[model samples]
Target: MLLKTFGWSFAVTAIGLVAAVFYGGWTGFGVVAILSILEISLSFDNAVVNAGILKKMNAFWQKIFLTVGVLIAVFGMRLVFPVVIVAISAQLNPIDAVDLALTDKDQYQQYVTDAHPAIAAFGGMFLLMIFLDFIFEDRDIKWLAWLERPLAKLGKVDMLSVCIALIVLLISSMTFAAHAHQHGGTHVDKAETVLLAGIAGLITYLAVGGLSSYFEDKLEEEEEREHEAEEQAKRSGKQQSAVLLAGKAAFFMFLYLEVLDASFSFDGVIGAFAITNDIVLMALGLGIGAMYVRSLTVYLVRQGTLDDYVYLEHGAHYAIGALAVILLVTIQYEINEVITGLVGVVLIAASFWSSVRRNKRLAEAEGSTEGSGKAEVSSGV
Candidate 1:
């Protein structure tokens, strides 16, 4: 089952390895392999959260996500996006950015790193909003009741999550880049950069999420009408097959997912610099890992893994929260990719085990209830 599902992913990964070799011989292949591993580790939580949203989409959208989405993720974000960033940040043209990347690797990394504070602020705030909205929303099943229960209570406040995010952003702007916060001091202009970038991220999230919701609502209404039509056709002894077209709603959702993926990629792209700064190798390796993540997303949706592992979504959101904070924190200091990856794995693993235990307990309770019911009937007789 696993092999058939992930066959394409494995094949793409192999192709990535071959591409890496062509780029820099065996050493390039090894670098690609390591970067791929790093990307997969860092973005595992991204795949989980992606599945949560992907399952709600229709089959056509789902396929698009795995296919068209891969192109956007790999080429657009992994390859082109960094170059675009460097170009804009350094006031260089696209050609110049690529030239610098190829000819002066250290200068390229420096330019990219120099843009890190803005990147972190934008990506971090967007991610934090996602985490915050999830935690504040009311859910029947609480994964970590000890923590979630209290958080859920606070959800009653109007725009509470956004307020919290704003507060955090304010604190980070003042503290993370202390010099920039000083009165009329220009040692570093990080405070304004963080503030503006974070606001941009927050606004993007709101716009994308709101528009997607509106479109999805319309799609739902259309589906309901189609379902009614199908029932009428059945009553009239006519066969009807409802064709699920890729409508505006799905298109908006596609946009939403892509933006979400781009936000997630910021950390991974920056982190890849720690492994190797060779633009070609980094692109190949990260692209391969991205393909696998997309494939994994489809597998999860098809297998209904999220439905089975109920608390898995909770864990992913928590990991995203941690990653957001880490991104903001790293604007001033450095953090190891290994540590970031490990934290996500641990949270997801813990959630998986908790879900299993809950399922087992529920099964046992049902069994006990059934056995007692049988005894009661016999006694009544």
Candidate 2:
């Protein structure tokens, strides 16, 4: 299994390199490889988080993720997203904008950089809201907890998030509008655009994520019902076709996995702009990152690593929270991309090492216990 996994990765990498070389020669291939490695290193936490979700998906969705999902990650997000952003912000035709990106690379970067603050602001605040919702919101719906209900009634975080985002948009628009006016540039009425962009981000998150969550819950309920039926059947000594139904059950797991993979790709694709304005480079780097992340997810699932590493999920969520903050800060502050990637890498590496040490200790304790048991048994004999 390990050999096959590595072999596949190697083959993909080779193909990417060959394509890069044919397109842009040695310089291009070298750049792609470096970017790919950097992206992969920075996204280890993404892989772990993705593994948690993929485990819940079915095999069919998993195949879709490996195939169609790759196209979305590589071309849709990396290539088309930036083009769309440029078109909207620059008031250029979409084809013209893409042509500008391909022809005037330096000018394109400047345009992207000029628009970075707003993008950062939108991404940052959006991420912050997601983190807050995930971490603080009650995961369970309890029936008989009226006394603690007041705490729950502290107002809907989602609505509050929207309000805060709107306020931020207003302030940003006024500030940028004044700045633009002072420079004799056309006043960019960014308030509506900013708010709309924020709404788009939120809607995307909810639409993709909400449906995924709903289906997952439905699948879980069905599974539980089936399990109960199976138990009752066993009690009555009745046989059932468990084998035939197993494949159908596995398909839901694939759907869950694809949804999660999409989520994990969000930050990486957005963050790639901090490295290069070239869509091709962004796609190359993030594609490699996505590939490795997919491989890592498989490894974690196969090894049952999450069961052994309790803090791994915590670390990934923490990284997501940090990334969200970083995205938000970028809206108002210029942050180095290297710093963002480094922070994620450090946190994930620390968590993984901690897991390794924990596993070693557990193994030692088990060994000692078994040795003591053998001594006691021998003495008794």
Candidate 3:
């Protein structure tokens, strides 16, 4: 099962490593490997979250995610995104941007760094909305019942999530972005840029996420109707076709996933320069990590891992909330990538452990109940 799931990922890794060696020798190979590991470590929560959404999609959509989505993730975000940012920021043409990235990596890195505030603001707000919406929704399974219950209750208030997100954006803009400074440079008030970018992010999330949810709900309604029809047919000894997400619903969901991925990649793209400024190396390395993440998402869906580990989604969202806060904080202050990755891993691990304990306790209770019933039956006999 493991080989079947991860065979393509392994192939990509081998190919990327070989190419990296040819491009920059063993040093390049080492950097690519480290970057791959780094991307995987940082985005593990992302995979969990992706699985939760992807499970609802039909097999065809899932295939599209693997093939087309991989291209967007690899070349579009990991490679072209930085170059595009540099071109716009540095007032250079696309050709010049590519040349600059290949020839003058320091300048390329600088242009990318200069754009970080806007990037952070945009990605942070988008991810913040995701975390907010997740926590606000009342679910049958709550990982942290003490907090989630109260939050879910508050969710009853119309647009409470939006209100809270806006408040955070306002505070972050006023406090952090107001006096943010570049390295060895004086304070530069980026409050306006942060505010605009954050609003754009928030709007994008609302538009894309809202549309996706609307269509998905429609799909669910249609599926429920089909389910009723199927039941009726079953009673009559007739066959009914299966339901699937299609048309506008699948398209918007695909768009939502792509945007969500872009938000997740914002930090990683910026942080990749800390390891290496070679665009090709970053793309190859992060692309391999991305393939593994996609594979993990598929495995989780097929294996029903989320169904067994009910609290896993909760943990991923909490990690996302923490990452949103970290992104906002990083607008003003430098944060170690190690701390970023560690926070997510720790949260997920703790949640997984809690889930195990919950399962064990439930099993023990069931055993006791069964034993008591048997004793009572024997007594009666």
Show model 1 residue runs off by greater than 4 Å: 14-65, 179-189, 231-285, 301-305, 367-381
Candidates' TM-scores? Answer: 0.77, 0.70, 0.76
lDDT of 2 by residue, 1-381 (tens): 776555666677778888778866876776666557555654565566666756665666556666776677667765677677667666678898788777887777666666655565456555555554544445343222353255346435546655655565566545542332211233444455555565666666667678678767866865786688689879999987665455555556555655665665665655554444566666666766667766776787677675666445445545566776665445434566557666656766676677778789899999999999999999999
Better of 2 and 3 by TM-score: 3
270-373 per-residue lDDT for model 3 (tens digits) = 54544454677888878888888888888888887756666766776786678788878877887765566567667777877888889999899999999999
Clashes of 1: 0
Per candidate, the number of residue pairs that clash is 0, 11, 0
How high is the CA lDDT of each candidate model? 0.76, 0.61, 0.76
Could you list the CA RMSD of all candidates, in the order they appear?
5.0, 6.5, 4.6
TM-score-wise, the better of 1 and 3 is 1
Q: Can you tell me which runs of candidate 2 are displaced by over 4 Å? A: 14-65, 91-94, 133-196, 224-252, 308-310, 368-381
